[model samples]
Target chain A: MGNADSLLQAEGLSRDYEHYNAVQDYQLTLKRGEILGLLGPNGAGKSTTLRMLSGTLAPSRGAISIKGIDLLQQPRRAKQSLGYLPDQPPLYFDLTVEEYLGYCGRLRGIRKADVEPAIQRVIKTCSLEEVQKRLISHLSLGYQQRVGIAQAIIHEPDLVILDEPTKGLDPIQINAIRDLIRNLAEQHAVILSTHILSEVEAVCNRVQIINQGQIVHESQLGIQEPDKVFFQLHLARPPETAQIEALQGVESVIAQDKGRYLISVENAQAGLQIVTSAIIQNNWGLLGLCPQHESLEQTFMQKVFQEDRP
Target chain B: MIGLITRFEYRRLFLSPLAWTLIAGLQFILALLFLVFLENFITELQPRLALIDDAPGATDTVITPMLIWAGILWLAVIPLLTMRSFSEERLYQRQALLMSSPISISEIVMGKYLGLLLFLATALSPTLLTAVSLSTGTQLDWGKLIAGFMGLYLMLASFSAAGLFLSTLSRQPAMAAALSYGLLALLFVFYITGKTQGSESVLFIYLSHFGHFLNLSSGLVYSSDILYFLLFSTGFIILTIQRLDSDRRNG
Candidate 1:
């Protein structure tokens, strides 16, 4: 996964359904060894964006490439390198688990001889060994989703796109699928679109949030760089005292209580050094100095709400 | 690959017990009607039959095969067989998996068409025994029997393509089925209207399904009739592929 990068890229892709702009100028890029999550509320054009990237739907404007193959111009070649799991799993309910996956493998252009081994690998990966022969319609939604995922990757496609893979699953099933997505990222570039922010937090390496047909926010895992700094200080009462106020990078300090203060600082680490060192040297009790960073969930909500229209 | 797809489709659609039952049921009903009509012909015209003993009637040559139990069954049951081809897929939303796969649209359409072709051939098989029985026992016109089957197969296959085209347009199987029947009924009316008026009705000629059916069923194979059904099948299939493309783009 680390050896190769940027398996799928969609640049300025847009779609218009009749008079409505379902997705407009949606630029999304997916790199190998990364699980990019497409996050948006319902009717925010998530499905449209996914369909266009997968070439299951064409964009009215812009182009997409799978491994540098032009999707709109050479769809068959581009689609050969891709796999898409639609919101509806597209399971042929009448076919058994193995039969459906085998058919999908063949459809995805896997050689006839390699199909059996491919099916076996997907079955094991998706934990469908027990239900391999069972009819898909009889399976629970969780198993059905697993089957859906199994079919999507049976051909060992370089880029796998899943739309709401865990929508109807229970928590246990959701956890299992999250683990499955993480496992898939070990080999393939996985792009999943969901409204579940926690899903992005759990499995994805990066996330691109689409709101009303455009990208509103993009973030990485681990919240490495927060857009805003939050400060939590524990100290002995230090007012606008020289030890605190005379810090070189001090912006402002609001003393919450005798022992606690909410300090606004220009640089978080700089603020931490001065405030903690000053409290210690001045013989004021140095309890704690914590700079709060935004969680992905908070960042997601703020970006979405900030751009939200009345 | 096409052969494998055709075989898989054959099993999926043609091997069903319900499919066999539909074919056998239609076969028996048509053969029974033929038996009744033949018995009446044998009973009422016994004396006249002696006069034309060495001469075959034009009605036997033209109308018997043209309007036979086999011919009507071929045309009538086609809608049921083909209405679910694409409509069922659309309703189930399984078409994404089918169309999104690396297979070309031509292969998919042709594979399913061949599968339906096999099913239609199966439906026409039981009546072949009836043909053999009459040919051996009553000295029936073997040429006409063969021609009728060939014509009916080609004619009905063209109609089935139209049914499949309508199926691709709508998700509701019932609506697809009704719309197919509605178009078939209109074609029949055009032929009837042409018969009502003495001269050729150009609109009726253009629309008449029987016009194509008659040209071949009478043991006379005209290239025009062959071209008409061939063009009809190819045109509808192309339309079906385009509709699928439109759907994927909009979806």
Candidate 2:
């Protein structure tokens, strides 16, 4: 099913290599201003899926519609709204940054008059102003990556797909690129694949973990409902699990080692108030209390490695 | 889109030292050959030609042979020029930029083809100037010179088209160049075999590029020869487009 306002939609996408299938029945629907992080291990078809979505690689058996235009039937029109950066940055090393971006702008069908402004805008956005006139081969890896991103967005496409935008970079460069991606999400729907788990947690509002050429897990990030809250509690005076479970909004309590307890509750705010008061009244000294959600790293590990245990 | 790609490719061609080196080297070789041809015409053929009526002029004695030599030189040079057209892009993974840019395969192929053709035309300019210089000292056959240049250009176009197709088939530029040289040399072999075999193998001669090129370079603009070049270039260009389309489809 396609959404009218969606920027990208694909159904039943599959890619078959010579001896085996690389991707199978991949599906995605991205609305405007949404960033979808695709996370997968090595050889998990993330690149293949992104390549198909960006109209660079054709799918064997599926339909993809970009801004409601069928990619297979009307690829040129559909691709006008799409931009992609593959795993390796597709750069002509001989051209300068400004020249390359200008070419990309023209290639993306920006008018001659608008190409300069588009180049300027992306140059400023990607913080490439100082090195704009330098040859791309002379730039460092970080700047090269920024230039790659600049070209992808120079045309102001509705959808931008990037494969491993920050695979090899220092922490500072990674943060800078993350900030750029976040800024891009303000206007364009972004789909990026990364090996870093925290990258998804930091930048993406939604994430999908793919393994074995199929999406194994998908969830919204940092948007948990109040009812599904878990709190880790440490008390100086030990208490039985039954006593904590008796608190009014508390769903269950599991005791951990060293006076620590993991408690699930119906509502986070009400449960915190009830549990704190109960602990004070019972004279069980509260050592530490904090809301603890399941980290994405654990989920990724389980979803990726669990399936491998045949 | 094609114009944008063509312009960018043309500009990029000039940015690399390889193009400049090839152009300079070709000019040096051709200029030396022009002198040798000029010296031979003056010292050995001038008196013999004076005794005969309707004798071969400078255009026939000097320009035609030089043009033929230029054509043969380009058979090797065009492959080096066209080898990087698609092969380098595919090797560096830069082809995705174009493939995803809302441009069709034909536009990409034609854009690259025209860009290389433009550069080859530029490389051919020195030879034309050398031939035109003869007009200052003697009567020059302008028709034959133009016909010879046209034939050489068409032959280069066919060589580049085939080279572009071979570039699409390989990721390494060296491999593409070798394949192109092999294919062009095979055509030359066909020409030699057809000439030696005489009337028995008309098809081979017709199929060979040299036969049509020779017809055009001899001040003969046969419609069949022009059509053969047109069909040969268009056929290879179409094959390049189909190969790229299949690469995208099956990738």
What tens-digit string does per-residue lDDT give for candidate 2 at B117-161?
A: 888888889889999999998999898889999999999988889
Model 2 misses residue A66 by how many Å?
1.0
Best by DockQ: 2
DockQ of each: 0.51, 0.85
Residue-wise lDDT of candidate 1 within A1-310, one digit each (tens)? 1113578877788888777898888776687778999998888899888878877777888988888888877878878988889898888777889988988888888888999999999999888999999999899988998888888889888898999999889998889889988888898899999999888889998899888888888877864654345677776655554446567667666667766776667766666677667677777776777776666778778778866855
**Cα displacement (Å) at residue A85, model 2:** 0.8
Clashing pairs in 1: A230-A292
lDDT of 1 at B93: 64
Cα-based lDDT at residue A3, candidate 1: 18
lDDT of 1 at A95: 80
Identify the runs in model 1 with alpha carbons over 4 angstroms from their true place.
Answer: A1-4, A223-254, A262-291, B15-17, B37-50, B57-67, B138-140, B198-202
TM-score of chain B of 2: 0.97
Model 2, runs deviating above 4 Å: B197-200
Docking class of 1: medium
The superposed Cα distance between candidate 2 and the true structure at residue B77, in angstroms, equals 1.0
